[model samples]
Target chain A: MKFVLALVALVALAFVPSFAGPYPLGLGIGVLGYGVLATAWAMFSGPTRYISLATVAFFGLGAYTVAVLSETLPYPVVLFVAAVIGLVVALIVGLATLRLAGIYFVIFTFGLTELVRQLVTYYEVNVTRTLGRYVFLPLGPEHIYWQLLALLAATLGMAYWVRQSRIGLALRVIGDDPVVASHLGIRITRTKLTLFSISCVIMTLAGAIQAPRWTYIEPSIVFNPTTSFLVVIMALLGGPNRLFGPLLGAVPLFLLFEWLSANFPNHYSIILGLLFIAIVFVLPNGVLAAGESLWTRLSRREART
Target chain B: MTTISRRTVLQGMGVSALATALSGLPVLAQDRTAIRIGYAISKTGPNAAGAGISTTPNYLLWVDDVNKAGGITLSKLGVTLPIEVTEYDDRSTAEETVRAIERLATQDNVDLILPTWGTGANLASGPTFDRFGYPQLAGTAVTDMAPDLVKRWKHSFWMLGGGHDYAEALVALLVKQRDAGTINNKVAIASVADGFGIDLSKAATPAFTEAGFELVYDKTYPLGTSDFAPVISEVAGLGVDTFVAFSYPPDTFALTQQSVVANFSPKVFYLGVGTAFPIYPGIAGPNHNGVMGIGGIDPDSEALAAYFERHTALNGQAPDNWASAVTYASLEILAQAIERVGDIDREAISAEISSGEFDTIIGKVKLVDNQLRSLWTVGQWQDGKFVGLAHTERAGAREPVVPKPAWVPAA
Candidate 1:
């Protein structure tokens, strides 16, 4: 039943580009882009409880790849290159840093973003002698929307596959108790690295798909640390443990931010910060957890009646 | 999807209504009461300080002043239409900028769209603005791609001349100082490793060498370098008579304060972006007087005085001496063009701007090949006022301050 509903919703969303104009299509593009990122983010960080802030590093690599190569290479080839780059970088970084957990891991991932940004900036300033590159691609808003929608579908499929597979069971055990998981003969590091690499590649693809919309690319714009923070926030607020939790969090929050930024530009940041604090306090385990508790209580009351 | 379909239906109705009104424009001239203008700019983010100081204030001031004077008179309609503005804060990100611009154009259906602040945002939205036939009078963007951009986007206009233009103009002034024997040909140059800084420093090095000046010291510091004492000391030790730094705001303030602390006063001291900011004088104190930077305005111009007074009165702070006036002048050009066309015909307005000359606070302004060629490239702080030191048109520039006055330590 849930799978059927999910399929229905996906089909409905797929039809948005057919009816919606530029403005709604623009918002849809943002929603779907963030959806893919948050979903992929949760795929790794959800069960393992490892907060990785290197989403933008991969995202930026993807974007910079497209910006540099899109004009000379075919779009599909550029995207594939972006994904390959993201995969290799993530594998190397995950292998090196997956041992460190908790705050240490968080700080490393955060630093990783800055490291990539600075490296790209240095290369641009020294090698290219140019900072910003103009991305004159044939892709328009509809093209971006369709591509992101398709990416979101692929991300969901992979995420669901991970959730249902033995890898998912091993990941859950690893999250529950790593020592116990080791006793159970699960290769913890391999499981974590594989998932992390996949998640990073999804983020990279999302960034590549959205780059043409920007029409210009620079280190600061693509490698903005805010992207990482927003992804984490959206994933957390939606109950990252569930398959659809990140999307649940992303859609409303993206719309709410749009409304807030539109209505109160001066105080939107303050309001957004307040809302985040409120969400953390009120929905500590996320909306899905809260909803599950409500369902349990209602079922108990119905049984009593 | 349901909500989207409903909104699309409403939009369709709105479009039909607009079409009907356009079809009966002779009868609906009186009904066209307001000219709706919209813009999305950085109001609360990394670019807020720049947008607030150089761009936003001018936009607000121009809109207010135009409405106060009974709005723009439409000679064809024989009626004056007040300007109505819808603003969005872009949060200084490309995604938000693109979305907000699209919303302004398609959702709000604004009659005209004003430019956002910065080179990237303007360039990011250039294709959109061109597709919608909106004239993009970019006041703050400085790029060598103006000629190419103008050709690609017909309605796009560049106000700030390229970095090469700025370098050549400053080098011209230095050549004059060299000819007068007020300073030696020895020069030191440093630049922040960012787009604006790199472009200027790259251009200046070649221009200075071409103009026969000895390049004594050259270096580049990263974007957010807080400590500049070492660089200042190194350059000071080099005994270079002229010190130029292509820097951003924080760096400009830091370099000036640090230079004062180190007593590294050169015969010709120059900085970049933040030198002409209203806050620079307060930060640099007495040391700001002889400091030259990227842009300048005619401090003695009567039009500038009025603009400054009005801007300060409206915003409770003085506009920057450099881009603020130019930004306001761009709006003035837009308003004049709209009035000249006597209607909200975007194509006509764009053509009017391309061809017409208008009196601006910066003086009579015209776009040659959709680029404003005549502009102040070098400015110096003189007697608490940032004054134009050199111009591309070779007119209205004040005499260069020879052997810059010693930096007075703040009491």
Candidate 2:
């Protein structure tokens, strides 16, 4: 029943650009892009209990890949190259930091983004002699929206598949107790690295699809650390335990951002900060979990009556 | 037991999102009697300080002034239309700036579009405005890419002097000072590590070397740097007699504050962008005297005095020394172009702007190939006021104070 409903939702989203205006379509594109980032991130980080804060590093890698290669290659081929780059970089980073855990791993991944940002900044300044690359893709708002939606669908499908697979069970065991999982014959290192690499590939593909919308790519804008933090916050806010939780968090959160930015442009950040604090304090588990609790309580009351 | 499925929640969200989007449609309707001019400015971000003094107030003043006289008189149409401004705070990010410009163009369908706050924002939005066929008369953008951008985008015009031009002018003044034995040949230069600062530094570095000045200390700091004491101490340790800082507003204030704390006083201390702002003098106090920076106005002009009074009356603050005149002058140019063409057709207005000359508060304004050719490239602070020291044409240029007086201690 859930599968059938999910399929219907995906099909409906695929046709959104047909009826929606450019503004809504643009907002949809942003929401879908964030959905991919948050969902794919939650897919690996949720089950493994490893907080990966390097979303922007992969996102920027993909954006720059498209920025540099899109001029010569097709858009789809550029996305493929970006995914490959994301996979390779994530494999190296995951291996080097796999031994570390807890706050150390979080800090390492956070530092990785800043290191990558500075390196890219230096390369652009010294080698390119240009402030940023100008992307001249012919894709319009609708095309970009469709591309982002397709990526989101693929990401959600992957997450659902991962949730049902044997590897998902193994990841959950490791997240619960790594020593016990290892003693039970689970290959902890390889499985975690694989999941991390796959998640990064999805993130990079999303970034590649969204890059043309920007039309120009600079290191600071593309590789912003704030984007990485926003992805993690969205996942945590939506409930990282469930596959669709991040999507639920991302859509409404992004819409709220757009609405607040349009209305209270000056106080948008402050309002957003307060909302984040309120969610953390009240809905500690996430909005999805809180809603489920409310539903459960109401059903129990009805049953009692 | 009743349960809420994830699918149900997703469907509900989709319905609500659609409803919200549909409801947002009515806000974009056009007002026919008003000439809608849209702009994305940095009202509350890193670039806010620059935009606060240089761009936004001038825009408001222009709108108020135009509407006060009933409206802009279109000689060709024999009718007047009041100006209506649609503004969005860009949050000082390129992505937000681009999105806001896109909204203004595609959603709002504004009659004319103003430039974003800084060089990067302007460059990011240039293609969008060009694609939409809106005339972009940039006010605060300063980049050497202006020539290429103007050529690439037909409707775009760069109002300020190019970075290379300004760098060359500053270097020329330094060379003159060096030749006159006003300052030593050794200099220290620092720049903010953004597009604007990087471009200025890149242009000035070679120019300084080519003009026979030894760069004793050189480095670039990141934007929003709170501590300049370390860099200032290093520059001071180099025993350099001249200091040149390519900076934005925040860093301009930070560097000056740190320099005073460290007592890193150079004989010729020249900071960029924000040095010409009124707040710089107000904050730096006695230390502001003898400092030189980018852009200037004729301090003695009655027009400038009147602009200051009107700006203070309207906005409760004085305009910045550098881009305020140029920003207002660009609006004046736009108003005159609209009057000449007598319509809001973007192509006609762009053509008139490309071919026409108009008198403004800044004097006779003419664009050579869509770039402002004759303007003050540099200014120096003397007696608490920024006076134009270098102009493209030296006719009305004020003589720069040589061997700048020592920094006075705060009272």
For DockQ, the strongest prediction is 2
lDDT values, one for every candidate: 0.87, 0.83
RMSD of each: 5.5, 3.7
**Docking quality tier of model 1:** acceptable
The Cα error of candidate 2 at residue A136, in Å, is: 3.8
lDDT of 1 at B30: 31
Tens digits of lDDT, candidate 1, A70-183 = 889998999999999999999999999999989999999999999999888888777777788888888888898889988999999999999999999899899889999999
Clash pairs (backbone) in predicted model 1: none
- Residue runs of model 1 more than 4 Å from their true location after superposition: A1-12, B1-31
- iRMS of each prediction in angstroms? 9.0, 4.5
How well is each residue in A187-299 modelled by candidate 2, as lDDT tens digits? 99998988898999998888888777776677777887878888887887799989889988898878767766766777878987876776676666777897888889879
Q: Show the lowest summed lDDT stretch of 10 residues, model 2 chain B.
A: B1-10
Against the native complex, each candidate's DockQ, computed on alpha carbons, is 0.30, 0.32
Residue B352, model 1: Cα distance from true site in angstroms: 1.4
Q: What is the DockQ score of candidate 1, to 2 decimals?
A: 0.30
